[model samples]
Target: MLKDENFIAQNDDLDQFNRKRPQFGGRFLNDESEIFQYNAWDDVEWNDEQKFLAQEKIQKNCSKLMPEEDSELLENRAEFFWDEFYATHKDGFFKDRNWLFTEFPELKRFSCSSSEEKCQNFQILEVGCGVGNTIFPILEAN
Candidate 1:
C-alpha cells in the first residue's frame, strides 16, 4: 500500500467565515463569440439554455458505463501512464500557477518572513502525481 501525506490547517484564533475574499483573476468571457480568444476565463455566467445544455451533456455522458476490466487495467497502470505523460510533456504542459498564492493567501502564513518571528512546524505535502506546477510556486514564494 502507498502512503500519502496530508496538510490540515487549524486556527482557533481566526474566524473562518469572516475572512476577506481574495481578488485574483479578472478575465471574463462576456461574449460567447470570443470564447476561443483565451484558453480559460475567470468568472463566467451561463445562460439558461447553456445551463440546460451542460446538464444534458452531463446526463448523456454519465449514462455510459465502462467495463470493469478496462477500468481495472487503467487503474493498475495509472502510474505508468502518468509517468509517460510527464516524460513526454515535462513541466511545459502547465504554466507555473502563480494564482495559487492569490487564491490561497493562507499558504503565505506558513513561511517565516522575519528573523524575530519563529516559524511554526508547518508542512505542505502534495500527494499523487503532477509536474509540480502547484507545489513549486508555493515553495518559491517568499
Candidate 2:
C-alpha cells in the first residue's frame, strides 16, 4: 500500500539523519538495565533526578572547609610527596598512553617517519610528565 511505502520512506529519512549525526563513540548507554554494566558510558544524558542529586551533592560539598595549617602543610610538602611517589613507582605506575596519537593527531603530524630525518629542533616541555609516560610515547613516535 502507499501508506506502507510512505512509512518506509520516513524510516529511511530518519536513518539517514541518525547516520549524519556526530558520534562521540560506539559505546552508548541505550538501555537503563545495562547502566551498571560499564565503567563508563559515552554520550549519556542524565535524568532530571540524577542531575538534581548531582547538584545537591556539589552544593553540600562546596561549603566544606579544610584547616589552614593542613592546607599549608600539604602545599609545603607537595614536592617532597611527588618525589617520594616517583621514587616509589620509578616509571612503572602509569601505562604508556597509545591513545595519545588518536587524541592528539598533532603528535603524529610532528613525528618523523622512518624514511624521514629525525628532528633535532623539536622541543616539548611537558609539565607534570609523571615518569615519562607521555613523553616516552612521543619520543618513540617522533
lDDT, candidates in the order shown = 0.62, 0.63
Task: TM-score each candidate.
Answer: 0.56, 0.55
**Model 1 vs. true fold: TM:** 0.56
Tell me the spans in candidate 2 whose CA falls farther than 4 Å from its real position: 1-26, 31-39, 109-132
lDDT of 2 by residue, 17-36 (tens): 44554333556877889879
> In every candidate, how many clashes are there?
0, 0
> lDDT by residue for model 1 over 36-108, one digit each (tens)?
8777767778899999999999999999999999999999999999899889988788665545555666765
Question: Can you give the lDDT of residue 39 in candidate 2?
Answer: 63
Highest-scoring model, lDDT = 2
Q: Least accurate stretch of 10 residues (summed lDDT) in model 1? A: 1-10
Which RMSD values do the candidates have, in order? Answer: 10.6, 15.0
Compared to the true structure, candidate 2 yields what TM-score?
Answer: 0.55
The CA root-mean-square deviation of candidate 2, after full C-alpha superposition on the true structure, stands at: 15.0
